[model samples]
Target: MEKWLVVLGIWAMCATCAVLFIRGATGGGSGKRTAAEKGVRPASRASAGDARAALND
Candidate 1:
């Protein structure tokens, strides 16, 4: 019936979307980098001496 056809079409669309989403989520074809790999580093914790120097400024 037409209703069953509609349901099948919708199901097919959903399956396609899920496949694409999973592929993208897994980075199938593109190069990806982590923060460290991109040469980004987190700032080190400030020491007490650094705080004193800032207060003196």
Candidate 2:
């Protein structure tokens, strides 16, 4: 029982470490810009009309 507990503890620690390592390697969700940060403006009707006209040609 003691050995099993030890193995379980080690496995849990290893899994936690792996998750932390992967999160750090992938920038931990901090690198992506939010919609507000990216300055995404709403498209105007005229702009959409122009895009449709261009696409048709």
Q: Please tell me which predicted candidate would have the highest TM-score against the true structure.
A: 2
Model 1: residues >4 Å from true position, as ranges?
29-57
**Model 1: per-residue Cα lDDT over 1-57, one tens digit each:** 999999999999999999999988887533334643565433542334657644633
User: Which lDDT value does model 2 have at 19?
Assistant: 96
lDDT of 2 by residue, 1-57 (tens): 999999999999999999999988886544344632565533542357757744633
User: What's the distance in Å from true for residue 12, model 2?
Assistant: 0.4
Number of clashing residue pairs in every model?
0, 0
Candidate 1: residue pairs that collide:
none
lDDT of 1 at 23: 88
Cα lDDT of candidate 2 equals 0.67
Whole-model lDDT per candidate: 0.66, 0.67
Compared to the true structure, candidate 2 yields what TM-score?
A: 0.52
